[model samples]
Target: MSEDTETVSVHGREFQRTSLDEGVYYAPVAFDDREESRLTAQHEIVSRIFGDGLFSPRIPVGEPEAILECGYGGGDWAVQCADEFEDCEGMRVRRLSSRPMSRQMDRPENLDLVAHNLNDPLRDPEIFKANHYDLIHSRFVFPGIKSGRWNGYIRDMRLLLRPGGWVQIMEYLPIIQSHNGRLTDQNAVRRWWQEYQGAMADMDRDPRIGRRLKRLLLDNRYRDVEVDIVQLHIGDWSKNETQASIGRDSVEMIGDLLESLGLWPFTSKLGWTAARFEDLMQEVRAELQNVELNLYIEL
Candidate 1:
C-alpha cells in the first residue's frame, strides 16, 4: 500500500503519522529532544554492556566493505560505527518517526543517511543493491516492524547481505524482572510494563521479539546465529562500581522512557487519560529507584 506521511503532535510531543494499510511504523515514541536524548543514553548503556563494540557477531565477517544500519535513532550508533570502520561506506536508514533530518548533519563523510519505512521493502535497487552490504545492523527496530512481517523482514535482510555478510539485531525484552521475588503483580513497574506490552500487542508489534530473534534467524536459514542477553539493573542496586554506574544511567533513562515511550501508547491505545498516565509514571519512577526490589530488564 502507498504511504502518506505527515507530522503529528500528541501531548506536547511530535510523531510521524503514516497512512498505510498494514500499519507498519507503529512506534509511539515522539521524535523530539527527549526521545533523542533517550536514544543517546540507551546507546551508551548498550555499548558499555557489550564492551564498547559496535557490532556483535562471533564469526567475523572481516572488514565490512559496506555497512547498513536500520532504525538509526539519533544516528549515534551509525556515526560511531562509521568512525570505527572509517574506510567502509555506510548507510543509515531512519524510520519515519525519527528526529528531524537537519539533526543528522555533521556525520562522517563516508556515512549517508536515508529516511525509509523499514516495514516496506527497500525499493531502490540502484541504491540498495542486491547482496551488496557486508554487515547489516538494526537495534530497537522491532516496534516499527509488524509482528507478522518478521519473516519478510529477515528475507529482505538476507537479500541485502553478501554471502558471508553478518546481520546484528539488538532488542529489549518488554517484561521487567526482579533478582529476588520482591516484584509482584501489584508493583507499579510491573503494572506499567503489562500495560505497555498490551499496547504493543494491540498494535500488532511483538513485545517479546528480543527472545525470539535467535529462532527467527535460524528458521530463516541464517547459519551460526548467536544470542547475547544482558541484564540491565533499574537502580543503583549492584555493588560493583561499573555496574552501579550503569544502573544509575538506567534509572535516569528508564524514568525518561516512562513518559516518552508510554505517553502515547498508554493514553492513545489503552484508553487512558493523560493525567492518569502521568500519575502511573510517577509511581513507576519511584518504584524503579528502590534498590531493594532489585528490578532489572533484559536486552
Candidate 2:
C-alpha cells in the first residue's frame, strides 16, 4: 500500500481509504480478513446461481490460454479458474487488484496476482500487453471505478483481449425490489437504497451500471455481447431446497454488504450520523428476514 492509500478505523472496523487524486482505488468497504471471507462466500453463491460455471457457455473460447480478472477481490474466482485449468498447457490466470495479497501456500501455480488499479492504464506494458488475454472478466467493480473512466476501462480491457476474446462483467443492480409488491415507500431498505444510489452518483460511481453493461460493451464495439440476470432472493422464501439455502446465505451476505458498503458513503458522503446509519440497517435487516415480503435483488 502507498501513502495515497491508508487504512482508517471507523466504528471499530478498519477500512482502506484512498486520496481523491490517486484514482487507483476507492471503495466504502474494508479490504480485511472479514471482507475477504465475505467475498469468497459471495463467489460461491454467485457460482451456484450460474450453475457453478466460471464463464458463460455462450463464450466462443474453449479452454482459454490466457485469462485476466480485473478487480478480483480475494482472488477467489481466479484461484478456482486456475485450478480448473491447471492441466492445460500454457494456461495462465492473471488477477488484477489494488490490495496486496499475502503468499498463500496452496496457491495454484498457474495463477498470478498483480497489484494494479483499474482506474488507471496498466502500469507495465510488458506484462499487460495488447491482445494478450483470451478472456477478461470482472465482477462488482463499478463501485471503485469512476463513472467517467468506464470507457477507458473497457477500452483497456479490450486492448488486452486477444482477437475473438470475451469479457464477462457481473454487477448488482443496487436496488432491491419485492417480487410480490410488498415493498413500500416506508420500507427502510428502499429508502436506504435511494439515498445510497444518490450518494454513489454524487461520487461519480454509477449505481445502475449493471443495467448499462451491455450498452457499454456494444458502444465499445464488442460483438456477441450477452447479458445474464441472476435473481437473488434475500430470505428463505423459495420452495426449492437449494434456492431456500441460497436465500439464507444471501441474507447473511446482504447484511454484511449493508454495513461494509454503506458505512463510509452514508456517513461521510451523505452526511449521515453513524447512529442513524446503524438504525437504518437494523430496520433493513428486519425487513430482509420477512419471507412474505419476497425481497430480491438482480445481478
Candidate 3:
C-alpha cells in the first residue's frame, strides 16, 4: 500500500488501496439524450431509498456541515438538494460530468460542483478529509467500482465523512432491470440475466452492490448502521404505456451499454447477435415494466 492509502472495512468487507484497479472504471457516454432519462430513472430509484428531498421518517436525518455526493452524474438531485439546504451543499464532482455539469451546477450559491476524476492523484485532502462531511451519500457506485476498486473508493468515502456522521449508500442487486409483463414465455429471459451474471463473474466483476456494504460498515464500527431493502415494480410494461416506455428506454440503454462495454465480445459467450441482442432486450423491456429488482442497503 502507498503511504497515502488506508484500509477501510464495512460489515466485515475489507478494502485496501491495493485492491482498487484502473480497470474498474467507467466513463459515461458524452451528452446522450438518454443521460437525462437514465438520471431520472436512477433518481426514481434513489429517491425511493432516500425519500424525495431528504425527508424520510424511516431514515435518520441530520443537518450536515458539508455534504459529499459521490458520482454526481447530472447534478440534478445534488443541485436540488443544495437548493434546499442553504449550508449543507458542498462540491459534487465526477470525472465525466466534471466539465459540463461543473459549469451548470455552479449556478447555485452553496454548490461547488467540479469535474474530478477519482483515479487521478487527489491534490486536496481537505476536500475529502476525514471527519469533514456530516453526510456522505452514494448511489449505484458499485458498477463504477469494477472489481478491485472498492477499497480505494470506500476509503475515499470514509475519509469524507465526519466521525459519527452518517454515510448512506444504495445499490442495485443483480437481476438487472426487471422487464416483460408476460404472455409468450419467461424461462428464456430469466436465463439471459443469469447468463449476464455469469458473464460479470467471467469478467472478474460483481454487480451486486448492497450485498457487501452492511458487512463493511459494521466491521468498521460505524454505529447505528441500518440497511433497508426495497423492491420497486416499474409496472407491467405491456399494459402501461408510461411504464413500458421507461422499460424500453432502459432496454435500449442496456443494449448500447452492452455494445460499448464489449459485454459480449465473444458472440458465443452471450449468444450475441446484433438482431438477437436487440430482440432479447425488447423482450426484457416487456418484462421490466411490472418487475422489480432488489434495492438493497442504506448503509
Best by TM-score: 2
Per-residue lDDT over 182-219 for candidate 1, one digit per residue giving the tens place of the 0 to 100 score: 98899988898889988988988887888888888988
A best-first ranking of the candidates according to their lDDT comes to: 2, 1, 3
Q: Cα lDDT of model 1 overall? A: 0.74
Q: Which residue ranges in model 1 land beyond 4 Å of their true spot?
A: 1-6, 19-23, 26-31, 57-61, 89-105
Residues 102-129 of candidate 2: C-alpha lDDT, one tens digit per residue: 2242568888766567777754775687
Pick the lDDT winner.
2
Task: Give the clash count for each candidate.
Answer: 0, 0, 23
Residue pairs in collision within model 1: none
Per-model TM values vs. the true structure: 0.89, 0.90, 0.67
Worst 10 residues of 1 by lDDT: 93-102
Candidate 3 per-residue lDDT over residues 124-219, each given as its tens digit: 664555667777767655545555555555666676666776777776664543332333325434655576667666656667757887877766
